[model samples]
Target: MSDNVYIAVHGGAGFHERKYEKEIKHALQRACNVALSNLGSKHSSALTMVEDAISSLEDDEHLNAGYGSNLTLDGTVECDAAIMSGKSGCFGSVGAVAGVKNPIRLARAVLDHSSIPSPIGRIPPLTLVSEGARQFALSQPSSAHLVSRESLVSPQAEERWRVWKCRFASSDPSSLSGNLNDIQDTVGAVAWHESDGMAAGVSSGGLLLKYPGRIGEAAVFGAGCWAQEASDVEQGMEMACSISGTGEYIIRAMLARRLGEAFEKGAGNSDGDDPHEVLHGVLNDQFWNMRRGRGEPDPSVGVLLLTRENDGRARLWCAFTTPTMAIAYVSSKNPKAKAIILRRPQNITLGDDKPCIYITGISL
Candidate 1:
């Protein structure tokens, strides 16, 4: 199969410049690189990026997500995640999975195997079954396997592993000791894998205090992530990207999605499928503040744009934020630059209209 282009994203949303220490920034960068490396070796599928990002969030204790996800009034870390495809429009999602690192990937698997995709015309797409889907998850390498819920006990290194398994494996929640209220964070990933082997994926993790009620877009399809024609997303009747930013972070990330929609509509349809050129127009486009929120200054979103091609093209774009600063990364056809790096957007524009990702119907 030809190596086609594919891209995915995980938006952290708003960030505070002073909040992230050098170590923190470096850690985030390393996670991005790890995500790509995992994908390249096929050790981790496109969906694995979702797990990679959330794992970092848990380790960092930032962005009100992952292990650090915000706490509810009662204090608990109930989480949610969603994954979708820009290609087949298939989506899968799960909410409140405790002890699981990559909720988004599981959701993507649901979409990949369970749902019946919308008809693509005279030709109809076959659907996947749950049994096969379960096998797919089991097939991953140890690094990609669903780490047992016991992995996060926060105990001495010698006994941490055994303790975690003991706590999480129990049939009764009562058996688990320390703070049963708050769990870890929620995670999700999106990707498009073609019959020819091209694919894309995205992920996000949020929530800290083990709060149960705070549900963000990452747990829902079309709201957080999307993709197309690559593999399984086409059935949803819409292809879109994933959302990793928090409530505030999500609102800010809108700017980037606005740009993507513009590209889809024709902001920069040059002679070829050069995504780099597409970014030139998408990132630079100017727009007014959109979707009024409770806060002033009208918020928006950022992006990490990626593109690739052997014969066909695949793109992965990630957007994230915190109170300190926003981060974006891109990966694509250029094998030399498989690593994800931060970018300074020269023209950060806000949209007055609410940030939205539109999924075209199969009929369209």
Candidate 2:
């Protein structure tokens, strides 16, 4: 296999200016760099690349995943995460798992250990929750036990939790408003490795002040993440997808799998239509429009796509419904990299002039 690799990441999907723009951009760039830098190493695969990528964002206090995850209504933090490999059709996820410093890492461990033998009569569960997941992690021969819940909570997170808890007691509905800009702040990554395999992973602290046991779209397979390995690359299509945004809406829309199916349908067309237009149309015309028409809260959505064509070049696409989507990308063909907070673009048609979903991407 060649050493070619590519990666992209988002801090979250909603209104997030908790830190200055420079700081946020730096975080995105740093995360992308961590993933892209491993492209040169022979040992790096798409699975490991994405795991490393999300770990960077999780460690940063500005993002809302591992160390800086949001608190539940009861002022406790419970995180959710999942990882899937396209080639093996294997997956692992953890939901409402607490006290772990990096949930994605635990998800990866589940994927790695799911098939291993336990004590004679025991069978390791593929997906784990709450205390079970934490205890499982400690039992494994991993480097360290799960971190204390206090060690994972940031000061900002603590303050936000306190305020929200007070509003909850007073029955103040005003504090429940979703910050559209920062709502898409959950992090994810999709990658295509030189070995001709695809993989994707997502991690998020559920919505602000959500119910204690809430498990968002991120922990659900084919909802927040999906990937399928190709048996014959020349004659068939291979796809991987990841979504960030309002978990409820994402679950309702079946965002990731639906998008992947559309790509598959595009491949069956003789004319070879680009999947980008199809993705944009679905989001603008079907998903976002329907939500707004129904008077539902339009939590912003961000999508990352990695697809492989028979020609051997990898196509990358990213789109978001928010005013701006923070992103960074790097590929072997282009070693130089940069991160940008891309603004949503509007298009004017003959009969209508409304904003269309903007997809900024590259083919490498």
Candidate 3:
């Protein structure tokens, strides 16, 4: 392996309570460690590291993915997940699926299946949903195995669902906000390897009391995750990004893919290559402003991005419009991963039409 291997993960972008801070940070750190643990294997690549890291996040009850995901209106755990490869431009997704142990694994399976030549002249599916997704899981390896739907629901999630469901039945407009403290939107990972270039993946349980068959940004192409290698690598950057936030707004914005395009076109400031400026511009013009213009006062979203410059320097960038976003990063040179819960300044004022976004860069 060439020394460019690295992975970063996010524990969602929303209101994270201080009480669960330790658990959330530990979960993100564990995911980074999990991704790096298999680096010694000869076949490890960015795709596998992204998968393993997200699988670790999915297993953590502190996250809103495979296990402990938000419950649907019917009190069932339905999930959305997707994975993409920058080198090959291969993409796969599963939407509103239940009974799967690791939704990201199933999404990876979908991606792998797309590579197989069809017996006939038929097109393969880029996404699978509901029962079709579960059926597809059955055909994959044991890693994508299915379990009881109830087994995926944690006690805490169930209690949250019970309370939320009661509030929903009351039809109280004030209760629409639910419990922001317990809201964890999505979990995702972005990775880069010398051999495979870059890859990104995302998984989510979706919003509390969401419709039974609702699919979130995690299951949509170019919305939840995007990874791409520049055509002119000698003068360009390879990038991968995973997003978490309000699924509807995110899906409409196509935030991940748009960011990749912005990086490619150098659409930042007058210098035209500042990643930080690009992030702020996109969040302001494309996301926050659009939502506010539509009469939505608040728009929540977070992006975890990995970029490798032509000179082989890798950096991690995180930008969010929410109260907090949890992230962790580790590289082969720095095997010890660092996890941080990035919180916007409490005193940061939100103007009537101005964007309230925070952007940070970390050297890898």
Q: Using TM-score, give the best candidate's number.
A: 3
lDDT of each: 0.39, 0.76, 0.89
TM-score of each: 0.52, 0.87, 0.96
Better of 1 and 2 by TM-score: 2
Q: Distance (Å) between predicted and true CA of 178, model 2?
A: 7.2
Ranking by TM-score: 3, 2, 1
Clashing pairs in 3: none
lDDT of 2 by residue, 247-356 (tens): 88888888887776676666656432465776786677657866777777554688887877777768877877666667677776676656777766544342223434
Clash count for candidate 1 is 92
List candidate 3 stretches off by more than 4 Å: 1-3, 174-182, 267-272
When 1 and 3 are scored with lDDT, the better candidate is 3
lDDT tens per residue, model 1, 269-315: 34234444443444333321223344434333434433334333344
Runs in model 2 lying further than 4 Å from the true structure: 37-42, 115-124, 142-145, 173-181, 230-232, 270-272, 284-286, 289-299, 346-356
Candidate 1 residue spans exceeding 4 A from truth:
1-11, 17-19, 39-45, 48-64, 115-211, 230-240, 244-263, 267-290, 293-300, 303-364
- Judged by lDDT against the true structure, how good is candidate 1? 0.39
Count of clashes in candidate 2: 16
Candidate 2 local lDDT, residue 44: 84
Question: Candidate 3, 70: how far from true, in Å?
Answer: 0.4
